[model samples]
Every structure is written in structure tokens, then in C-alpha cells.
Target: MIKNYRMVLEYDGSRYDGWQKQGNTEQTIQGKIEQVLERMTGQAVEVHGSGRTDAGVHALAQVANFHMDGKMASKEIQEYLNQYLPEDIRVITLEPAKERFHSRLNAQEKTYLYRIEMGERKQVFERKYIYGLYKSLNVEAMERASAYLTGEHDFKSFCSNRKMKKSTVRVLKEIEFEQQGSRLLIRYTGNGFLYNMVRIITGTLIEVGLGQRKAEDMKGILEAKDRNQAGFTAPPEGLFLEQVRYNV
Candidate 1:
């Protein structure tokens, strides 16, 4: 009997090439997990992630699933995988999932966080994870600009034009910015996001904060729906997939 298992994972993306398995290259998070599973079960297995995090993007709770004929207890499977997998990747939770549950398709909501440090002194320990900016930003203007980004809208202006598989209309549920001295944290909760959406949004807001653009300009950018209308995409290291919510 084939049994499906769900896993909640956390990983530091500094040394890995995102979550998807690339052709034969073992540097990806998915590739590392698949290799360890293949070695443990002595059969080729595939793991599906909730979503693809770009290279250098971190994850706090990435969901994934795999099916196997061998029936092992959830604890045993978790322990076995963790024992062999690299130190950076960790399986935080494991359990049986409904046979039809898909990590990506069944997801209801996703949360992402972008970290920025604005000061003369670089964040010594968090230099790799957070973005460092030297200039002071007008936080109130950025917050005013964020209000325009909420609600359902075509976000093509904020997404990468490289390759898009579906419609760019997405519901941006909420955007919150928290400030603590020289550190700023931007959190996004949404139904879905297009390629490079969060990063682009951050860049546009930063432009507003810099007095380069007015807060009301966000409406024009959204209406334009042209990638060229948006600001630059932020660095990958500042992004983190915080959670994936499911109905089940």
C-alpha cells in the first residue's frame, strides 16, 4: 500500500539553490532531500514542495509531500530523513496525509517576510539574510503606498516577465511593515504571488520611501500592468517564505 506523508521543513537558503530539483545537480533543497530518500528506501522517490523559492531565498515553514510503498511510522521517517540529510535542512513535522493532498494545489494562503537593515553599521550576523541599505527612508510614505497594493489586482507590474504560467491577477491580503531602530521587516500575506512579486513590491515601496515617487503613483503602476513601470526587484537573500496554510 502506498502511503502519502506531509512534511513541514525549515532551511537556511544560503548554501542551496532554492527548493526545486534541478537536472542532476544536488545543490537544491529538493535534490538533497530526494537523494537522501532514495538512499534510505533504495528506490527512486520524488518530493513535491508547496512552492518554489528562488535561489538564496529562505523558508521558515515549507510544506512538502512524498508517497512511498514502504510503511514506516511518521516518527521513524522523520528521524531517518533528518539523520542523513544535510545540517541546514530540517524536517520539523511529519505525518500521514490524505492520498489526494498536494502541497502546492491544496494550499490556501502563503506568508512571506522581507528583512532590511538601514544604518551605517551592517548587521554583522544577519548580513547574509537581511538586505542592507545606507539611506534613510520615509516609513510613513511607504506605509501609505502599501495601502494601494492591497486587494485584488493585476500585479503584472510587480512580477518578473521571464516566464508566467497563469494569470497575474492575485489578491494581496495584507502588507505590514514593522520597524525596530535600524531594522525593518515587511510581511506579506496573500492568496498567491507571481514570480518576483514580493521583491518588486518592496522595491517600489522603497522608491516611494526615498521620495523618488509619490505614494499615489502605485495606482498608476498597478493600472499600467507593465513590468517596466515597477521598481527594481529586491535581493533574494532578504526574502523568506514564512508559511503555507492549508484547509485540511
Candidate 2:
């Protein structure tokens, strides 16, 4: 009998092309996970993820599901999978899930984090994980700008140029910024995200922090609904899929 299971995964996606497979040219996180599963189970399994993160983005709590034969315990699968998987990718937790559970379709909310380093000295160890912005940022300005992004809005200005099937509207539950020493973290939780949404938002927020854009300008940007009205999209290396929530 085939059983469905969910796994929580964490990966440093700097080397991969993204979370989804694209033709034969690019290395993707999903493709890597499928390859590991195939090697362990001696069968091909399709893995579904909560969302497709962009290239160079990381994930701390990405959820995915796959079907496998027999009733093997989740712990056994987790242990063996970790042993064979590459160092950058790991299965943090595993559990049997409902047959109808689908990682992408069943997800209710997602939280993403964008990290940046301020000041002169850059941390050599975190160069791959965080974007280094040498200029000083106004945290209060960023907070005020972030407030404008909360609530339901058509975020077309923040979306990438790629085609999207769903509407650009998203409900932002929270948008916050915090500083810890040289690290600045921007956290966003929302019902859904469009392609490069978080990165674009971060870019716009950075503009506000630098005084290039005013906090109130975010409203006009939303109203314009034009991609050109927003700031440039930030680099993917600083972004991370922090968490995914599902209905229990």
C-alpha cells in the first residue's frame, strides 16, 4: 500500500536554480529531493512543495509531501534520507499525513525573511546568506513603510515580470523589521506571495530606509499597480522561506 507523508525541510539554496525543476538545464531543490527519494526507495516519487522559492533563496521550514510504498515509519525515512542527502539539504521532521494533504494546495500561510548586513565590516562567514548594505538604514522609516504594505492589496508593483495564474492581491498579516548587532532582519507573513514579491518589497523598503522614497509613497505605488512604480527587486541570496502553516 502507498502512504503519503509530509516532511519539513531546510536548505541553503545558493547553488540550486530554485525549488522547482525547469527542463534539463538547471539544478533545483525539488529535483535534488526527488533524486534522493528515488535512490532510497527504488522508485520514482513526485514531491510537492508549499511554494516555489527563487534561485539562491534559502528555506528554514519548507514543507513537502511524497508518496511511498509500504508503511515505513516516518522516523526511519527521516533518518535514512538525511544520511544520504547533501550537507546543504536536510529533513528536519517527518510525519504521516492525510491522503488528501497536498503541500502546495493545502498551505494556508507562509512567512519569509530577508536579511541584510549594515555598517562597514562584513561578516565573511555570512556572505552567502545575507546581503551586505554598507549604508546606515533608518529603522523607524522602514517600519513606517512596512505598515503601508500590511492588509489586502493588489501587489502588482512588487511582482516579477513573469506571468502569474492567480491574482496579484495578497493579505499581509504582518511586516516587521528588527536589528541585531550588524544583522537586520525583515519578516513578512502573508496568505500568498507572487513571484519575487518579498524581494521587491524588501527593495522598496530599503529605499525608504535610505530616504530615497517616502513611506507614504507606498500607497501611491499600490494604487498605480504598475511594476515600474516600485523599487528594484533585491537579490535572492538574502531571502528565506521561514515557515509554512497548514490547517490541521
Candidate 3:
């Protein structure tokens, strides 16, 4: 009998290429997990993730599902995977799922976080996780710009994939900004996101904070639907796939 399993994962993606399995010898979070599953089950297995995070990105919680013919307990599988996986990758939960459940297809909402450290002092320990900026950002300006991004819109300007064929229209449920001393955190929740959407939006907001772009330019950028008309894409190190929500 085939058993379907749902898994919650947490990983530090600094060393991996990305979430998706790629060409030969390219290390990825999916590739690593699939390899370990194959070793444990003695059968080839595919782990489907909720989203494809870019290189250098991290995750607090990511969901995936896989089907295999096995009799192992879910808790046992979780422990088994953790024993063989790398130090940076951890299995937080493993449980059986309904037959038709899918990690990506069934997802209802996803939250992404971008962190910027503004200070002259270098963050040595957090260098792999935070985007360090030397200048202070105008928090009020960034907040104003974020308001324009919270709604359904064609996000072609914010996406990095120029050859995208899918619909760029997506509903942004929330866009929040918080500051604690030198640390600036930007949170985005949406029904779905295009390639590099959060990163590009962060860059654009930073530009507004720096006075390089007016806050009202966000509206024009969205209307333009051209990637070149938007601001730069922020570094991947600052991004984290914070959470994924689904209706059971």
C-alpha cells in the first residue's frame, strides 16, 4: 500500500543552491531530502515543497509531501530523516496526509520575511542571514510605499523571471514593516508570489527610504508591468520563507 506523508521542514539555505532539485551535482534542499528518503526506503522518492526559495535564502517552516510504499511509523520516519540529514536541515514534523493533499497546490497563503540591518557596525555572526546596510533608512517612507503594494495587482515589475507565462496578478494580504534599533523587518503575506517578488519589492521600498524613488512611484511601477522599471532585487541572504498556511 502507498502511504502519503506530510512534512514540516526548517532549513538554513546558505550552502544549498535552492529548494528545487537541479542538474547533477547541484546541492539543493529538495535533492538532499529526497536522497535521504531514497536511502531509507530503498525506493526513489520525490519531496514536493511549498515554494522554491532562491539560493542563500532560509526557512523557518516549509511544507512538503511524498508518497511511498512503506510501513514505517510517521514519528519513526521523522527521527530517521533527522539522523541522516545535514546539520542545517531539520525535520520538524512528519505525519500522514489525505490522498489528494499537495504541498504547493493546496497552500492558501504564504508569509515571507526580509530583514535589513542598518548600521556601520558589521554583523559578523549574522552576516549569512541579514542584509547589512551602512545608511539609515526612512522608516516612514518605506511604510508609505508598502501600502501601495498591499492589494491584488499585476506584479510583473516585481518579478525577476522575464519569461514568465503564468498570471502575474496576485493578492497581497498584508505588507508590514517593523523596526527595532538598527534592525528592520519587512513581512509579506500573499496568496501567491512570483519569482523574486518579495526581494524586488524590498529593494524598491529601500529605494523609497533612500529618497531615490518617491513613495508614489510604486503605483507607476505596478502599472508599467516592466521589470526594468522596478528597483533592484535584494540579496537572497535577507529573505526567509516564514510560514505556509493551508485549509484542511
Give each model a TM-score: 0.96, 0.96, 0.98
What does candidate 3 score on TM?
A: 0.98
lDDT of prediction 3: 0.93
Q: Which has the greatest lDDT?
A: 3
lDDT digits (tens) for residues 105-212 of candidate 3: 999999999999998865788888989877899999888988998989999999999999989999999998888789999999999999999999999999999999
- Those runs of model 1 whose alpha carbons end farther than 4 Å from true positions after fitting are 162-165
Cα lDDT, model 1, residue 216: 99
Full-model lDDT for every candidate: 0.92, 0.91, 0.93
TM-score leader:
3
Model 3 lDDT-worst window of ten? 119-128
Error of 2 at 227 (Å): 0.9
Residues 85-135 of candidate 2 have per-residue lDDT tens digits of 889999999998899999999999999999998868668888888988888
Model 2 Cα displacement at 94 (Å)? 1.0
Clashes per candidate (backbone, < 3 Å): 0, 0, 0
